[model samples]
Target chain A: MSNTPLLSTRGLTCRFGGLTAVDRVDFDVRPGQVHAILGPNGAGKSTLINLLSGELRPSEGEIHYRQHPIHGLPAHRVARLGIGRSHQKTNIFPRLSCLENCRLAARIHLGGVIASWRSRAAARQVDERAEQALATCLLTHRASTPASAMSYGEQRQLQIAMVLATAPTLMLLDEPLAGMGREETSRVTGLLRALRDDYTLVLIEHDMDSVFALAEQITVMVDGRVLETGTTAAIRGSEKVRDVYLGRHQQEQA
Target chain B: MLHRYPKRVPIIMLALTVLLVFYPLWGPVLIGDGSDFFLEKLTLMLILGLFAMSLDLLVGVVGLVSLGHALFFGLAGYTLALASPSYSAASLWWMMPLVMLVSALAALVIGALVLRTRGIFFIMTTLAFGQMLYYLVSDASFTGGSDGVFIMFKPTLAIGELTLIDLESPLQFFYFVMGMTLLTYLFLHWLIRSYFGQVLDGIHDNEHRMQALGYATYGYKLAAFVISGVLAGVAGMLAAMQYGFANPAQLGWHLSGEVLMMVILGGMGTLFGPLLGAFAYELLHYAFEHLTLYWQLLMGLTIILIVLVLPKGLAGLILDPPRLRLPRVGVGGLLRPRPAASTKARLGLAGHHKHEEG
Candidate 1:
């Protein structure tokens, strides 16, 4: 378990008709490491994340987590096996209170959903854990607030908190900073930094600044293929990465 | 702090008290009075109310709008008829439990199979399964082979005194039915407010989100479907007992349609909505039966009118549906902008954390 990558994908390929969404992509995230997958639009970064999280099955290759294959398992089963994923869309339970969203997720982690319904004692304990999760997410003040009524940034935070409540050893975040204002992003980034030691995080982001700032290891993808993977500094220094991604920076200056 | 007891108990008790007390006194027609017509109507209403609530669990709470609930009810009726020694002879009290168990088992098997499909496919699949059961019972000689079976006696208590429930006396049967109906309501209310109930709501709002939260939504939906089926089945058994026989007509599509109408008319999701719908529906049936022989035609028209006019159902008119309300977050709570460009601020902190770990 010490040497094993929290999540590793080998030759993972997903094809839709004649077009390939992800083509023979190999990726890995070491334990407690923040691995960022960076790509332009339609670059298959999301498809790769989807495959790793068991939301989509690979047409080729295998996905291993903690040395066990998890390629074709249902998303819920994958979550149960210690991988928590937040969607690109803010997908927290809208009707549920902010606390309830986290609590239900935590309850799933404890495997008490079945007994919790009939047993008052079990439900009380789950509620307490849910409250604790809310506090951990800096959402204690809005514990009873419905997720539907939260500001866009708050909703995003709640989505991440909901995933955290699952108690996953590995976290898969698809574009966590997609729609956030600068302050919100900073607050969330601070929270993400605090979370670094507790779980392995795989983040997909178009925000270069956030990616460059957070990623220990960075993988760049283009047209469904992995172009490069290395330390962020190494990747930033690479001529290919500059030509493929940072060319836009030159174009903007021109 | 409010987690110690079932959340909806007090509300259910209040409703039951009003139903049991006022309805018997001024609601007209007592059982055992040669024409205990009103009492009989009340008993029928209670049975239908139970049926509607069962359907509501699937549709209102679980978001599975099913059309085959009556199949469980009708099948239970047939079970009681086949098991009893002559529809007139009193069946043992334990047999009622047996009937409910069998009906519930049928629901479980059926729910498990059909729950695999969703949306229109789910509705159509359940209807097909229900029709298959109806035809099977109608054709089978053991269940009176389409003509239906008559009970020789009412159900009797299995206790020391061998207390037989006298269905012949409308008042006794009325009280018994009322007690069972109230119990079913309470049980269902408890179930809906429990942790299981919240999960059901989650599944309803967003199943994908629930699954991601680590819940096996499929299992929860199947369980809810079974619970609803069993309740409907019990109501069916009671209906058979009251009517003194089980008929092929009881298993018909029209009966299924009628129950759907009752559910919608009362209010699809409200706890007392179904009971109110049943009461209104039964009263309409009573009036129509006296006024015209083609009463079903008028009843069908009435339901269509109700659907067109009050799509939210009766309960929606009286009460505001629950809404999500977030208490305002004051300005002091929101994080203020940092001086050195927030992204850079975050980057420095993230870098420091990483370096410390290294």
Candidate 2:
């Protein structure tokens, strides 16, 4: 992997009214690495992801992706610049089929005014990309099924499939396993591991086991600030991260 | 619902097309010489149907409920009247395109401003823009100050020395309108199944997700608004040709509301529904008028009944018959609250794990 970070934030901050959801934080994700962001609820983990994805404008900071400043750019522009994100809350077009959901994301790379008179099915490349994404996420069997009809785990897979279909080099995923059962969680973990070879991932997850297994780098946050940033083994050995976030999580599990 | 009975829908549509195409021939036999009057009415209905269909592109497909749709419709009529010489007819070739261009420009400007807002604010802003235009035409002296302007002659379509369509005759005008309506329906059918329409569907379903997928959704919406405006302009120009007058009322909010009602009455998302609605609404208006002086009251009651009974509108009857079961009328039934099960079922969560997070 290159030493130059694919995406890096310098002094990033987001304040909602009087509450600073994300304090001034410097963070980075090297190319082709699974970088996991772990924190308790309201640790500004999702907020940081939102900032990187351009869903929310930072109050203070510069976000550089591939050395291009992208802080103030809108989400669509950020996405066009090869960044994609999945929502914490399952955000997919529920009424549309799984294939259609992926097709909509894949077609963005076609990059022109959509021909209003042509059939959507005629775009063979978009369909192929969509099918490939579904296949990657093991959702190819559910291609014709409406998203709402799928199980919650399948829906989460569809969400990742949609981002995958966009063909972004860097992906910001918020809690991809937030509500999945054990089997579903393991399946998604496997999917993420497979994805690690192809794309740089910034994951915000509460599932510590999967976080340790899938991520090469880990960042722990507490109360809108980064507590630690290190390799998985380094973070596992950190005292401050244990006391602030992981200790409480383990206690709850116990 | 429409897709469920796909085989039947085409057959029904084919039958309807056959009926409409042969109406000119068969209509006179049934109505005698008064068929001309009915034909004129039908032509007007077709024009309004086109208008409603254009609005549906925004309201139904793009999920933009624009209350200012009449602005384009009325503006096109005024354009035709203004461009035509007081003593001579204008060429259909140029005037039609000019009016459409004007309407498109207006939509582009207004959509750019109003699309920045969401939901109720968007609706109000559109309504406000439409009202502003209405007053501009109503109070302005050059626009005849609510007295309206009249077109002296219908537009002529000619290729050099040969006249292709003399839009003056009632029979010819009816056929022209029918042809236009068919073309619009076919075009819209193809459009809604296209890549552009799929993006629109995604926007309608979840705009934020579409944005995350890297679509500049604003551009798509603006394009839809402009395209819809241009189509509404065509309908407006046709109306002016038929009536030979452009009035302030055409630009009024009531007309906009009426077109909205037509869209709802037919079915919001179905391209064919708006046309069905326009015909049904106008036919009801005509029938009710002859039945009593208090026709509006009867119309109001009928509409309320239809809405309560057929929540999906008239198209629902053909699309999904099973769901159109009438509510049982009983004192206990009326008093009892609806079961939550049905709501869950409607959401497609009937057999799934209810507590699972979406």
Task: List candidate 1 segments past 4 Å from native.
Answer: A1-3, A117-125, A248-254, B1-20, B27-35, B87-92, B162-165, B289-301, B321-358
| Docking class for candidate 2 | medium
- Whole-model lDDT, candidate 2? 0.87
lDDT of 2 by residue, B53-129 (tens): 99989998999998989999999999999999899889999998899899999999998999999999999999999
| Per-residue lDDT of candidate 1, residues A108-185 (tens digit) | 777566767667787787777777767777899999876656777887888888888777889999999887999999
Positional deviation of residue B107's Cα in model 2 after best superposition, in angstroms? 1.4
Which ranges in model 2 have alpha carbons more than 4 Å from their true place? A112-122, B1-5, B323-358
Give Cα-based local distance difference scores for all models.
Answer: 0.79, 0.87
The positional error of residue B25 in candidate 2, measured at the CA in angstroms, is 3.5
lDDT of 1: 0.79
